[model samples]
Target: MHDQPPIPGRRGFIRQVAGTALLGTGLAACTSTASHGDNNDNTGPLRFAHGVASGDPLTDRIILWTRVTPGQDNGGGDIAVRWQLATDAAMRSVVASGTLTTSAHQDYTVKVDAAGLLPGHVYHYQFETGVAKSPVGRTKTLPRMDVRQVKLAVFSCSNYPFGFFNVYADAALQGDLDAALHLGDYIYEYESTGYGAEQGKQLDRVSEPRDVLLRLEDYRRRYAQYRSDPDLQAVHAAMPFIAVWDDHEIADDTWRDGSLDHKTSAYGPFKLRKLAAATAYHEWMPIRTPDPAAIDRIYRSFDFGSIVSLHMLDTRVIGRDQQLMMSSYFDANKQFDEARYRSDLYSPRRQMMGAEQMAWLDRQVEQSTARWQMLGQQVLMARMEYPKAVVLGECSSTAYVAAKRRAALDPASVTDQERRWLASPSLPCYLDSWDGYQSERERLFAIMERHRKNMVVLAGDTHNAWASDLFDANGRQVGVEFATPGVTSPGMEGGQPQRNPDDVAAMMTDMIAPLYYAQTSKRGYLVVTATHEQVRCDFRFVDTVQQHQYTAAVERSLRTLAGPGNRKLEECPPV
Candidate 1:
């Protein structure tokens, strides 16, 4: 499934490079603000309302993006946009320049792959229409030769209604990143009355359209609303972003054929809705389409000289099978069907990346010679199964806490039922994650093991920070996983406000063998620095997302050494 060559002509610069094929395809800040192209005078000039952005950097090329908004008097029509890439912020020395036209068909958004640029160099870019110029955006090309290190700001699950984007603001202010990696859930597909509605009302950040997205226009409006945020705009202006979609981009719990949130009866055909979402995603997002024909095929890889090989995978839309639900395995009287559930859970046919994607990943891993092989993906790859009683709601968190205390105080006082519940067999906490596709996960593990590579997986979507040891079915360490907390989404503490979040985190760390660290109360992001010696992740959290003004601090720092036999995470002193 190699990408075809770059298409010809104006759009020809778009190229897709995964393992070996060059396929022709197609931030934030409180310190910066984006213009929505709203003009009180109907005859005002065109505006770069969405600001400027760049992404998917190769040694010689990078994708630049922006949106053009026309004044009411201008009417709906095609507008020619001019772009320039320069080595200096003042645009004194230009390197690449191009002219492209955008229209309402693409929501007036412009994206161009600026080529013929030098590697490992910082460049400034901007979009222009008449005298209306966009904010200057900063981007860098991937290093083509030996590199000492690469730093990335990792983020996910930024539901607009949830809270302020202080996380993005903090990252943008630092201004010391190679790029930003967004592991899906960049946008939540919920109506005003959905997921973060109450918070949105309090923060005055309610979702636009006021309904769940189903059409192309609906999705575009939502992206516009999110991009309009000052913090989000500042980040994009600061550096490039390598992003992949999780379920929320289209609908909740989206698989290949359908989604849990998409009601065919009310939303029309799921395929149509999915197509609309994909179209909007490509148009609004500064990402190069690997295969323009197959909009869902976003899995690709990036090489930072010989230091790192970053593989961005699509674990959500491209090839996911329908998630298995526990309710399906229950009988009339609520008797559990453990055998049936286990059989389906471990079925070789149940796929996460399907066959083609798995083959692509195998080839990528086998061919890469970089010191670190990193996967920037959505969802946790580590095992997070909990006791069956806890998963089935038979044992509440409070009850479990009490039982543990009682057992510690007097072993003789423990009841048989309490002991049974405490010692119950484990079941996966979220079947929607890799835990549901165990066979596929093992296959991926085998690929890493066979190549004898140093693997580090950066993940999101759980809305909590976690550091875990990745082990295969045979109990051999394959790698380590560092999951970033949500940008603004609530964590485990959101569900259990009565209990102390630290106690919850401690309980989880105790129960899960592979889990080395857990922070289940905060909303934050991860700054991952990969070097020849090790890959360090700094889990930084903001004090509150409930307000625009907040303070951020490093909650934890952990690292995994790079080597054949070392694939576990070790805590580091806070910086």
Candidate 2:
């Protein structure tokens, strides 16, 4: 069934590229901090409260951020903050220095885009106001055009109350990452006591607002509570971050208009609540904005030298239509029919990236000059299927069995029915991912093929590690995908109530054609290395998140060619 729906009307974006260019030129020209006098002194109370961070990196520019409070308490009101970026740690060779005033409107947080630094070079930055100074943060710009390699640390799903952010500290201690990528769920919207009672009590950590986040102040305080974590701060202090929002950043299962957790009936208006979340996110995080008015347009592209182009996407908000619910597919008997079940599933009208962003993505890929293109977005783009045997073995719930049957996956003991159920391949494992929007997934593959771009997709949110081959609808290989495990959020093994997690992952890997690797139980981040030759991804898992002190190991490593014909993938022996 081929369905080609008309593209939706494009929402206008207020591009700030020209204005930012002029500001960058001015910032780059300010090469000394001598004129600032005693402003750089640091022998007083803590004014720079939240420490320092940098993000949204470019070849010649990067954004710097810090929060300033007047007193040691959770203070309010406005204060002047001074920021300086230097080529070295000594603050002797200052490249850019500026002063900005922060008020309660922005929650006393400050963000500055420091430009004119040399590419592929390490730099030091700090924020100061009065006698208070922030901890010095290390940051770097994107590599030059001829650079050889880049190493990135990717993390996601950091639930503060769930456990200690040991994974963040672990990645920071690695000490060799050029930059970090946050694939969303940076802050969950759940209340402290109910969601993570045991861990929160053990860690003595509680979320702000004391309830589920809905108001602007509620979201702001939640971010503040999370930023107060020492381990999270250390990770931010260690390197620049490229971040994008997922469903939890606003609320669970968020789309363009509403969310699962937040409803217009309860939250007053979806737009207001969403704007509050987005506003708080921008205020706390050090991200560059092309236009302040158009906050939802976060689909941007960055170049990591000539080796790779990083395309960051906003899949949860701004674009996605409402997700297809499983309840809608069930029949009167809770039974299944293949043709009727898949009709709505493959609807051409179901949009994922939306119309405008999809067109924008096509242009970005088509005009790219880099050797390899990498998509940093939330949700898995690979095909995952749960075999009938595994389902029957692991799940005993009648409701689950009914749902499977409703999806046309009959597991009757009859030979033909069982055989067909087991042999029917590539069923949707998780509807929350790209599987839910199969037509859009196929459309992206068509775009990649039309542009002749060899791409790699980096995804997180399932809290599991995965390696899969991306294929077009015609079964032609398009690219590869590496999905990182969550930083602290529980995974399939420990989080869910299931039996034989390892067996399920192994079964999927064996039965699924596209999937080469799968680890359902482990919790860790991904270390990605890109070069002219190939891109290598290492899945590093830690021993535990329940404790602050834990050990880590690379569970698996996989690599794919940069410029490819057949696009062969190689898995190395884990050390």
Give the per-residue lDDT digits (tens) of candidate 2, residues 253-367: 7888987667577668989889999999999888897679999888899898888889999877977988766445547874445466478778888888988988999999999
Please, what are the lDDT tens digits per residue for candidate 1 over residues 361-400? Answer: 9999899989899999998899977667765667664566
RMSD of each: 9.6, 10.8
Q: How accurate is candidate 1 locally (lDDT)?
A: 0.82
Top candidate by lDDT: 1
- The runs of at least 3 residues in candidate 2 whose Cα sits more than 4 Å from the true structure, single-residue gaps closed, are 1-46, 72-76, 387-418, 495-501, 573-575
Window of ten residues with lowest summed lDDT in model 2: 13-22
Candidate 2 residue pairs in backbone clash: none
Candidate lDDT values, in order: 0.82, 0.74
What is the Å distance of residue 182 in model 2 from its true position?
Answer: 0.4
Cα shift from native, residue 42, model 2 (Å): 20
